[model samples]
Target: MSEIRFDLVTGKMVIIAVERAKRPHDFAIAHQEKKGSKDCPFCPRNENMTPPSLVEIKDGQGKWLVRGFTNKFAALNTEVKEIDVPSLYRGEYGYGVAEVIVESPYHDVTFGNLTLEQMKRVFHAIIERYRSIVKDEKIKYVQVFKNFGPRGGASLEHGHWQVIAIPFIPELVNREVEGTQEYIKKERKCPYCEIIEYEREAGVRLIGENEKFVAIAPYASQYPYESWIIPKEHQEKFEEIDEDSLSKFVEILKPLIEKYEKEFEMPPYNIVLHTLPPRDIRNYHWHIEIAPRLTIAAGFELGTGVHINPVSPELAASILKLQNL
Candidate 1:
């Protein structure tokens, strides 16, 4: 039966249309990685193409594995300019930072190709960049995300992630904070904490888990095969996670993407890290949201801001758990 479910954490709603659902294989798309062109800036030996790295992780042989640098075509700039605007339009200087974290030196491989040790180093780069960027007092929010394929908003095929620090807190973020805080106040407990416990007990939506994290297709999932990799503990910050526990995160993430490649034919997807704003860490537990770009938002979705998911979270989790890996 089709029904509407509201997300207590994000305060969003989604319609699960059971009648329109199909087999998991039906959503497969061949998202083959393209060969790296010599002119590709992210390619190795092309260091001159981009500015010097802001942060870099190198192997024992001193070969750079991951590099973080200011985006050449940054949407936000660090330069602060005074602006006196007319009354009709109010704006401030585009004072923020945009950076790209090259996940791998090899351009042909997607993030899924990174070895277990390599994946940890890439995240080490990510957490370092995130911590350094968030320290800037001018920035209110820092976003860490990866666009996997062309359909997922990547102009470049190389596996990389972007970190953007903006001057003001975004509307959706503010809403997330406000809404989740209210849930905490009403329930007298952290909703995410209870969710982990609840879903663990339920097991219907649970996909996988490790010592420190749980991977699940959320009960209110808005997209097919969408999942959340959340810390088992009630952690407020992503970078604050201890080093020993990071392997647990990498363990769950690597296989899920492998499963996606095998089952979904490497469908384009976005990996979004949801954490608290720099200034406010109230009533929030950080998580990594995997939003697969299998379906497009059409008129109903765009018009109502409500997503229609053909497959239910139960089915999605079942299919994902079918993987022996």
Candidate 2:
């Protein structure tokens, strides 16, 4: 049997086709234990390999725990102040900031492998750069994202995350903003906050929770094992995360990734942070979305701008909860 679901944020349709999962699993990943890449620029003692640090965090021994540097192959740079579009056509110079956060000192340790303390340090480095980048008045939105393994779009094996600050709001984020605004107008409340409250009570789609955060498989999940960690309150900005909340955020995230490791066998996945832009958006709640690339986007999904998810989010949540972290 099949069912159709609509995502509130993206307004995209998804086909929940259970028959698609009738086949055997295809996500058996034989992960090789990686030793240090001697020439890897992100490794320790490779300071000379990359551009000087934009910012960094140091441990008690004064060794850099996490580092932030401008991307050598930056998609956008601050060099171009502005560009005027031709009257006949619409375009502008790539005028923005592209930076990378080297998540850890160890070349092989990923977010899942790092000590909880190191994960917090990585986030602090990310936040430092994100706060600095967003301060630019010309920048409209800043995106913080990570790519892990092959299918997730990682070119380098070393653990790292990237932040790209752009001149205008991107389409995906804009759609989300529109969705939140419409939900508020119609129901006089925040959609995400409502979702958190609903899921907390329902418990079927929930994976884990703590005092400040709850991890859940969104009701209209677009991918397999898709999970989201969100604040219990109505915090709209990731930059506003205090030390206590940051620790709580890390607490919930660690186990979800561990669950992925146990269930998917280290499958490639994307982690994206969706937060309010520099401009204000009322009633919007910032959260992190983990989209595992266990399935591909075929013709119907690509052409029609819809997704066909084989696993029901409810079943996925149940299976994920069975795996102990």
Candidate 3:
């Protein structure tokens, strides 16, 4: 078989074709152990153990359906008022916002279990938090993510997501923005939008699609079974997503999560939301990446940036599509 290669062009949508594919049985799934009897602070009954709510969604009767609070073991604490740094390598500072979003009162309710209405509320709450945090002049970026199961970095058995607003742009984000800008300047079009249009037309790596969004296993997926959810419209900032589009986003997203859970047997995964910097909207495009924890990072993967995945995305998409998920 010939080796697969990807060549990203300036104005054209590129879809690399893979010549070889692996069967599902060839891949191994990691099973996680359930949490033991240690008291989980995220449990609804133990909500008092956590920091006071920053924001919450209330039921018609005024009961909390979902809640957001400052993380107890935060990477950045607000109380540390003054940070003194004399050297570049060594620095002391508390300059970010870390908050936990408790998804549901029920411990078993994962993202897949969320109803469409509940998921819409969750997205709304996330936008509200992002808008609030960006108003602070110190914050440069806000990252929203969820770690599901132990493999994906979930410490607690209870399902929850986290949002971190940082004072500086992360190196990864900087590189992505620069790459995007370079591509846009040369092509006069968004790289992501080009990919979306190409994926829809190729119809090979497509996992799912709806009126306003399309989920696809990227041609250059870094991990096996990796997928991305992109909005049909070119929206730079997630917080700026209008109500109509937000509803459409939820409509497509909920089923994708359910498909992963049922067909992939609830594989552990990480979900990341990438958007534009609060003040800038020139090059960035908002999207969600769902990376399933299907493989461990070995020395080669760490030493070199390239990843080796045994399962080709076209085959994975075909398998996922056939499953009655």
Pairs that collide, model 2: none
Instruction: Give candidate 2 regions above 4 Å deviation.
Output: 1-36, 81-88, 322-325
- Residue 225, model 2: Cα distance from true site in angstroms: 0.9
Distance (Å) between predicted and true CA of 133, model 3?
A: 1.0
Candidate 2's residue-wise lDDT over 157-218, tens digit each?
89999998887777788888889999999998899999999998998998878889988899
The TM-score measured for candidate 1 stands at: 0.86
List runs of model 3 lying over 4 Å from the truth: 1-38, 79-92, 322-325
**Superposed Cα RMSD, model 3:** 10.9
- The per-residue C-alpha lDDT of model 3 at residue 212 equals 85
Shift in Å, residue 24, candidate 3: 38
lDDT of each: 0.82, 0.81, 0.77
Candidate 2 TM-score, C-alpha based: 0.86
* Candidate 3, lDDT over the whole model: 0.77
TM-score of 3: 0.84
| Model 3 worst lDDT run, 10 consecutive residues | 10-19
Model 3, span 40-59: residue lDDT tens: 78876687789999888988
Clashing pairs in 1: none
Off by over 4 Å in 1: 1-35, 84-86, 322-325
Q: Candidate 1 on 1-325: residue-level lDDT in tens?
A: 3233345566464433333456666434323344566877898899899988998999889989999899876767677767564555434556778899999899878787789888898889988988888888989989889998888878778789999888777767778778789999899888888889999899999998877988999999999999999999988888788887788888889998878877888788999988898768587889999989999989999889899999899999998873432
C-alpha RMSD for every candidate:
9.7, 9.4, 10.9
